[model samples]
Target: MLTISAWKRFLIWVVIATGLIFALPNGFYTRVERHNDALAEIEQLGATPARQEAVAAWPNWMPATLVNLGLDLRGGAHLLAEVNVTEVYADRLDGMWPEVRDALRDARDQVGTIRRIESDPDVLALRISQPENMARALEIVRALAQPVVTLTGAGARDIVVAGENDVITVRLTEQEQAATDDRTMKQSVEIIRRRVDEVGTREPTIQRQGADRILIQVPGIGSAGELKELIGTTAQLTFHPVVGRTADAAQRPGARQVIYPSIDEPGVFYIMEQTPVVTGEELVDAQPSFDQNGRPAVSFRFNPSGARKFGDYTAENIGSPFAIVLDEEVISAPVIQSHIPGGSGIITGQFGVEESTNLAVLLRAGALPAGMTFLEERTIGPELGQDSINAGRIASIVAFSGVLVFMALSYGLFGIFANIALILNVGLLFGLLSMIGATLTLPGIAGIVLTIGMAVDANVLVFERIREELKTARGPARAIELGYEKALSAIVDANITTFIISVILFTLGSGPVRGFSITLGLGIMTSVFTAIFVTRLFVVMWFERRRPKTIEV
Candidate 1:
């Protein structure tokens, strides 16, 4: 408010300073361990121009190495898997021997106790009779750890173990393969995260949603379909039938492999391989290369134990057909012509660079426990993402300039104050995004554009009010005071409602939508501060110099 010009000046300067720090981007002002790692990797590869530029820029000018982009702007993929919570419950119950023992004891006594025990979304112990078996039931309940199966007994008496039972209760009661508690679901999310990392989409965002669902965002993904194919398949490796291949076939199917249904890609080739004369699961690492036949192949070497296993398998399976299937496709079905017992082997197939790299990553990680399916599919091509980013940047500059010219032209000399505030408002928005590490998507850029207009509008509101007060012949300071007091409520009310909507969007939306909401919301706050405090500070300095009774609006 004009009531405290000195305080306003201090606050505006502070906001501007803080925003500058944030706007610089992490590592821009300082180099760290991350810069070294990237440089090392680039140098080791004998950096191409692009890679060299990335290293030269280091923490500044370069995009953040770990900077996570929203799925839309960066062009990535999302995959959701249905976790097998049934196995988890079974395993947990197996481990909960003491509690199970106590519950069974109560039931055996024919007293009021846990009658039936079934575990589905959440672990449960059903109450049987009453008073008689109550002692054993109490004992069973006592034996459970606090984080153990959320006790939902079918009796009149109950207790809340935690503040929110919603996270641990039998909310969706019927799915055996599903998990309902925070612990199990969180565990599943962690596992999925590990699995996605192995898939080798760098800096992917994997998090849990609700109790059972997982949210995964993989940025800079080239093939959304392929990622869906790779991640959606649980890659649950097992020995199975590929009856199509005969050891003495007239011609081999490129390499000896069988096709099964892919869990990730429906109707796609799944590897029907149980008979691994050698398994990559045993391989410590794999590198891609072209074989002697000029065909793309992956070269892998096994550990000592794996070497022994491979040597034995090949020796035993001599003259038998061994297949190598991946994600259900029979890439090769090479026959064991003889006992070629080496710890190292090559997988030659229809391999492009990405396909080989992805397969190598997956094989290096070991198999998953179950199949997975995609709940949603989204694709953002590289060309399109770049175009959008360019458009957004151009639009922001244009919109901002337009706001500046309009404010200055309409308000005359005072509009200069509005322009200065508007520019600071932008810097503050960038600073906030950098500090908070919020992703910036194309939609978020639009939010920034909108914020520029709003910042100018807030200044206009204040200036108009000041001009009106000046009409009553108030002194310069008094006119400014009246202006701020009147405009404060309208500015706060309008921005607060918008902020609430932004909060809702952030809370309910996923991936890019959340990014947009965060940027938009930050923009609103920054705009309000810049316009109210910053512009008012400029007005104070102006009034002190000119002592004008009326200001142009």
Candidate 2:
């Protein structure tokens, strides 16, 4: 008999119900989106009357997951930025200065006096008073060279040291530069992702394009310029010892001192020591809070090592002004009133609540490894996205309606069963997408249209086989059973090959290609299930009830 067991029949309906339930939220996308947003805000900021009303827009018992709309379908900001990895070379050489100076100082009896010379940003040049001792200085600097950590750079020293006529120059080796560039790009991508996530945007695409370029696509952002402002701030915070205050911007701060303008005060600058006591890299946490004066401020805590250094510096430098520098500008230069032992500090400045909150976010996300130059930027409008959505909906409807009509006409009653299965197949596809939190793009819609066409292939094969079996004078039940058994191998073989291709596409492709692959891959699984199991179940149930003596294809 072509009857499904009780457990199998029950399982099939349960699956179909679950899929439809999960997919239900998409039908009321706006209401459910508002509900989800309200819920998240309630969890983060506590509920208000407006938020509570929004939350009540959708029922709490239903599945709240909705497929994330891609950049093309939702409108967003797009940017292609080239990271200045070479900037790190200058910072690396500057950090190496103290070590180099200390090493050369050990041989001062032979080397005489050494002074750092103004040179190219990537090169650290030093002039020694004694010309003949240059060999000794070179040896000391070369001894400080560490082996590069990368696979291709193994056994190679990170720095190249050379001397000529009393001047010694140091620079990063080519292999080390390559390794540093790679690290810089990876760090840039991660930091950009964190900054964008801080804004609570959905499914952002922050990916590396080439060697030093990054592509960022953020859905629902106002503009590319706004996005650039959010991620471009380096937020390089450092606690430097203030040398003196200055009014003249052109004032020359002697060697090893930098002059930075005060952020809040006009026409005032602070001369700061080049070496910082602590940097934002040591910061463990930062949050927006009110200072003692009840003004908006950012509160920060340092890690243990930073805490120790900060505590010692404050303890010794009481009554002296300490420069709180961000991106080379002194934001605050407050006198150390007393020893602060706990490593916690508040940054008070001319800021509103929003500015303080954004500052806290930037500090928490950490500084970008280097600066980036925007190579390309674009802002897509929601009106354009809505147009794309309307076009895709029309295309999908046309395809779906055409498929339903064609299937019904060709296979008669069996074709109606196939059409019902095809409908369920689309529902199941959306259910899977919602469950996985997949982003749906325009190409993904095309995949759905393709799936609707392919969904009836198995049913067509089975019905044609049954037509052949009926001609052999086989009983209706036996013919239906043999038809499914014969069609099973062909269905699995065809879908399996296509599924493998989708997997490969997903593995290698990015952006829209990835979106298409995800939908196609999921569509294949649902289509096969509906075509074989779902349509067969409908046929068996109808036949069992009607007890048809003869059936027409």
Candidate 3:
């Protein structure tokens, strides 16, 4: 009953030793983190003496991963923003105007001449020259409708077209609006995450809250305002053909053009076509660099189609000015000196080095689908997080010491075996956490303490079962075998039930609740393995080595 194969013994020790090796790095977490960060920087920006020194501080062969601290344990910013999904509805209508015009012009003989009329931004109104052909006009516009492809809006039209007298009104169908909202939220989350990651934060949480909201929490950030500035920029970069320069702000060139003030020159405005020759959507990469005049600038490259369009426009419009607009402000309107065949160009303005880098980051991350209004903001201080870490440390020490003493006093030598297993179990837990890069928070520390108390329950049950068998006149070895055999069911049932509870908590909870669930769940698995397997191995080794004819459990 106490026998163990050499292979199994080797495998068990291998796992324990591997876990200890991985957990060792956490003892020097600050140094390891610095080393890792230095390595990443070197990879990104090339090697420097300081970075090389930092990388050399920690060996590459050693485990470099550390447990990521959660927002509660690290100073950071938190924000809850509501994405304005309704804004996309107006944009959708504006984009459909060209298509609608083309469709009506194709059927002009049947519907007569069509003229766009003023209405709400979310609604398209067109006046038909022929009033009697209203039904025919409706039929022609309705043919442009497409089915909404979503679970909630399946089989529903994307647009609804209606006509009364000589006027026709167009609006997005309810189902299409719902689908658009979902897509907008998803795009917003991704863009926000990309923007946050570009700054090289350790771990940022960018997630959707509901139908039209997003929750962002980034550890190690200074304040909510800083985070808002990082992801809040619409960064709608567009290159438009400059019609002319004018001092009059009231001058209206055409319905399809607008005027914007110059960034460098005050009191001067440039009237440019509303339709952009190229937009940031086609940009594949952007980086901060210096212009010919040694000033800070952002260099960008466009995709194939964007490059082709840009080349054609530049070749045809040489010696003409085109304005580079960002957030409705013209950065600079420069004349095309030559035909640039490649998709690459430089954007220059009165920008500092930091501004140039930030612009590059934004261009690389792409633009937000729609604007967001922050509903809540918070900035957690590092002092509070330090206090929390200190408190958690003291609590863990107290709980661990108490558990060790109680076990030793209760079961003597056998209890010492359980204590040793318990120590290794904690090591294994940290090992797994580091390997997975799990985030640890205050509640996660509590989960570890709870695990310490529960880890010995199976041992206690087994020891009690052995004592009962001894009273029945069984031999020590036989009593031990029967003890482990009979206690297996109870141990499995109890741990399985607790594991299920952990799963349910993880599923329903967020933030700190989730951190606690991760540790609790991981601790359960490690404790069961150490208690049943490692402790049993120790007990069997003691029994076989001593060959005790009569002994205590």
Candidate 4:
């Protein structure tokens, strides 16, 4: 009566074989990793002879997916950075100056001549020549205010306008500021993630810590300094119409004008409009290429909206110099010879090939919404990671060996069958991990060790029930059948509860805790299958062949 159907037995062995095959790559981690990296490079940059040889290191027909190592196991760079969200307020005010000027000019007869005055970075102050027209100026500026677009900021205006005497000031409201801070934080996290992904590092964690702080952990990077260099550059590129060139650093520009020194020329500065014709935010693509003179450069293309604005600006400003600014410095001021219809352009400066390539990468990833100041930085060395791995390896082996010895001593032939199933259970766990591309941390290793011990509980339960069942007059087959049937409910109940806890941990926790939960959840599924199906199948096969009238579990 205790028997597995032919199809069921076939299905069980097939699953076991597939799992072991998928898990085989981890046995040769170094070679398989090189093969994977080489394949990625070939897909991205085309193949070289060396890359082809590396790809051949692993056969194409075999499974190549690997379980990623977490930062704790692989060593990496960690950084805590605080974003300068307030900086966007100044930029917002600067951009609003043109609209404010246009609105007030429409009422020039009432407000008289308007001029910008020196004020705080967060405020836009305007002075009118007519003292009695202050109310009129305030009304015009207040009319330009729009409702904030965020859900919590409903019914709140984005800008607040106030006036005293002949001066009117405009600044963002409190609700608007809060909304802007939220947007800034989200954008910063995404941009940082994009930059890290561009470098192809494994399993980097980029998450917001608090209101204006971010936490970054990148595995397999050389140092925190290297990671900072990769993501730190603002790479804020803009094009503005040049007002004039000057060498006097102390010279003040009129309203709506800014001065920036040339990057290549010493002591030379260019005064330019504060408003840009187009910004890097509108860029859709950028690539490293050679300019007309065969010098290294970065070629960029804009989205549709940006293309129209760029084309119109170039068409109207022929023969005028346009300054290309990067991070408040003028990279070049080239004269527009004719109307350029296309949205594509090249940035030429003092750049090497590597510089151009890196620039292209940054441009494609988009500029950070605001600047960041690093608060804490640390680099974990690989030697520490190797020691951790060695310790985990020893722990897993000890746990596995101890479990095998105990099971063999207690239950004779049935114990041996349980031991075999336990080994397969571990193999199946690793296979599932590889298939899902889960990251393995030190805590994850501990979870696997715990799983090895827990794997035998179901077998022990079934074997004990069989021992009691043998006391009756019923034969070995009936006792075995009843033992498995009776123990099924307890096995499912216990494992299901633990699996739910693992799911909760994964949902609520982060970093190493998540790694542990993933391994534990997977181990539960694999262990249950081996204990119930695999061990039972082994016993049934032996009984069918030998047909022993008397048996001992």
What is the RMSD, in Å, between candidate 3 and the native fold over all Cα? 2.2
Off by over 4 Å in 1: 1-11, 24-54, 58-68, 80-148, 151-185, 195-215, 225-369, 375-378
lDDT of 2 at 506: 96
Deviation in Å, model 1, residue 351 alpha carbon: 16
What lDDT tens digits, residue by residue, belong to model 3 across residues 427-479?
99999999888999999999998998899999999999989988899889999
Order the candidate numbers by TM-score, best to worst: 2, 4, 3, 1
Clashes within 3 Å, all models in order: 21, 0, 0, 0
- lDDT tens digits, residue span 470-548, model 2: 9999999999999999988998999999999999999999889888899999999999999889999999999999999
Q: TM-scores across all candidates?
A: 0.58, 0.96, 0.94, 0.95
Error of 4 at 445 (Å): 1.1
Instruction: Give the clashing pairs for model 3.
Output: none
Compose the digit string of candidate 4's lDDT tens values, residues 452-493: 989999999999999889998789999999999999999999
Compared with the true structure, all predictions reach lDDT values of: 0.62, 0.93, 0.90, 0.93
How much is the lDDT of residue 468 in candidate 3?
A: 92
Q: Would you give me the overall lDDT of model 3? A: 0.90
Q: Which candidate number has the best TM-score?
A: 2
TM-score of 1: 0.58
Overall local distance difference test of candidate 1: 0.62
